[model samples]
Target: MTTHERSKAPAVDGAVLIIDLLASSAFPLTLSEICEKTGLPAASGHRIINALLEHQMVALNTSRKKSYCIGAKIFQVASTIYSKQSIIPFFYPIAEILKNEIHRPIFLSVPIGNTVVVVSKLESSLNATFNLHIGQTMPLHSSASGKAILSMFNAKEQLNYLAGQKKTSSHFSELLPKIKADLERAKRLGYAVSQGDIGQYVSCIAAPILNLRNEPIAAISTAVSNEFLTHQEARDFSKKLIQAARQLSSRIV
Candidate 1:
């Protein structure tokens, strides 16, 4: 075979071997483990692992000693791509306006795997009581921001997702019916609400942000102290939250 043919052959095999190893449960593998799993021998596996590490496609877990895992570079690329396609920047002005109008903390959240992670937050200038830092993850069955995103999925999908959570609360089983009912109500009202679910004395209202294909990709929410809003006031804030979410969705698509 030609030199080009010989070079291409191992490259294809190495790529496939790397992918297979990554897909296995034996991840965060040491060099020995990777060699054994891929049948690539020590020297070959070392070269492959080094190449992946150099590209930041794989990472070393120094704390775990000799373990390797997926790297933050993947997420960095994903965040960059999503930001380019998202309406988040476009909706900042409107989110600020909503914060002023509702006099509450406003937040924008997007689904990352099984969790809803906060991407942006606007603090309430009026009270300054409740605050949510960006990058915080909320429970799907509890938080209004999470429910708004969960509402986009069907019942079976939602149940399957909840089942996969290792650390589910006992409250989840007791409140499943109520959670379903709330999701139904949210669908009709175009938003969702939560009271003291994630944090004591705090309440939130949220609505979904739909993508170009009309699928829910993210959510926007306003959070406040329970003392700040009465039942009726909370309901009204949910409406404003829906409006803001709709506005943001429109801009993205």
Candidate 2:
């Protein structure tokens, strides 16, 4: 064995291999699949996975039989890394300006694995029943912020995220086809819209903040009471959001 290989702890290496495998997969994998893919012995793989499960490093996919995916702890760590990026520090001032101009609650969200998590919000004067807080998770294919981010992903990446949904409800599962269609439209329009996809009587319009490579690093969105925003008002909000996104993207190196 090479020096690095000789120094490795077998159990730790196995655990890491399993983690890497799970991280790379779009959908969850069964224990047998994990072992088969990682070349780990069945017994060792099971034990390592159980240990990861106990520590919240891996989670069971209840939607799929005996399958596993990266857990909440991984997402937490990813969010921490995202918070330290240069883009995050620059977000608040831009979002604040957008919120003032639009007169709606503004949200900043970053992708944490396959989902988007809200990292900041600028509260609006309107007493809208719905409010998004920092650390709140949103569906990749549903919410405006999520959709905006998704729109920037390549087709395969977008489909992988969509296919990996936990399918919390049959209604959401049934909407997958439509959601895919909406993502395409979002790509063309340079923004995304959500009508009650998250909260009752709530609507959001969002645009993706891209990095130098033109990949979406995050999204900025405005939420308003659907009851109050007219079609023309929503259109105005979308234009403002797209502009803010472009401004923010320019700052990203």
Candidate 3:
């Protein structure tokens, strides 16, 4: 078999080189410092930095106005990487066990902006009307998995997320009170339940998978028929889900 040479782009290479320099620096680097270290032309470096800033790959330091550092987007990407690599591997067996016990579809999700994206899913054999797949994004206030993750956030963080929701959701103002109530109940119960909030004739129960700092890094949820959404059964499912979430979280490190 013949091996193929890799393609390269000078502009992309320079951007990566600039990111590396910023990442290795003890402090934010000024534009001149970045150009000097990367050996790129000043104009080209400035354009690259501006592009990075636009995409939130890099950010201006608040204290040092002209200096730049890594941005929140990079850390968000890194967290997703960490979750997929370190955490998801430990989730399958636990999810499989939960799926078997509850006879419902199980999903594993991680936060992205104000939403949660499904990273893994194990479907149930039962003919349930509800369905979810990998890469599907769910609203934080409407879905069990999203609520589970949100419930773990502090009041300030929760408020920030909800505030951002106003920009995209038309009924956000009206839904605010109910969403807050749901979050409080989720926090109190150590799990969240969405009764027909995600779809008709289906309900979901989820629990947050926390990191070492007790912050939610991911959530595990099971989607079941509305028939099982009754008080006693919902509590039962929540108890099992919370246990599985804790078990998976314990093995994350």
The true-structure Cα RMSD of candidate 1 reads 10.5
What residue runs in model 3 are displaced by over 4 Å at the alpha carbon? Answer: 1-85, 127-129
- Model 2 misplaced regions, further than 4 Å: 1-82, 166-173
lDDT of 2 by residue, 133-198 (tens): 777887787789899999899989876776677444556677877888889999998998898866
Higher-lDDT candidate among 1 and 2? 2
Model 3 vs. true fold: TM? 0.66
Worst 10 residues of 1 by lDDT: 1-10
**Ranking of models by TM-score:** 3, 2, 1
- Evaluate residue 96 in candidate 2 and report its C-alpha lDDT on the 0 to 100 scale: 83
lDDT of 3 by residue, 1-253 (tens): 0112213666787788888888879999999999888788999999999999999999999889799999989999978765555678888899999988888888898888888988888888875646677767778888999999999999899988998998767889998998999999999999998877667888888999998889998999988778656889889989899999999989866
Candidate with the larger lDDT of 1 and 3: 3
C-alpha lDDT score of every prediction, in listed order: 0.77, 0.85, 0.86
> In candidate 1, residue 42 scores what lDDT?
83
Span of ten consecutive residues with least summed lDDT in model 2: 1-10
Model 1: runs farther than 4 Å from truth? 1-85, 166-171
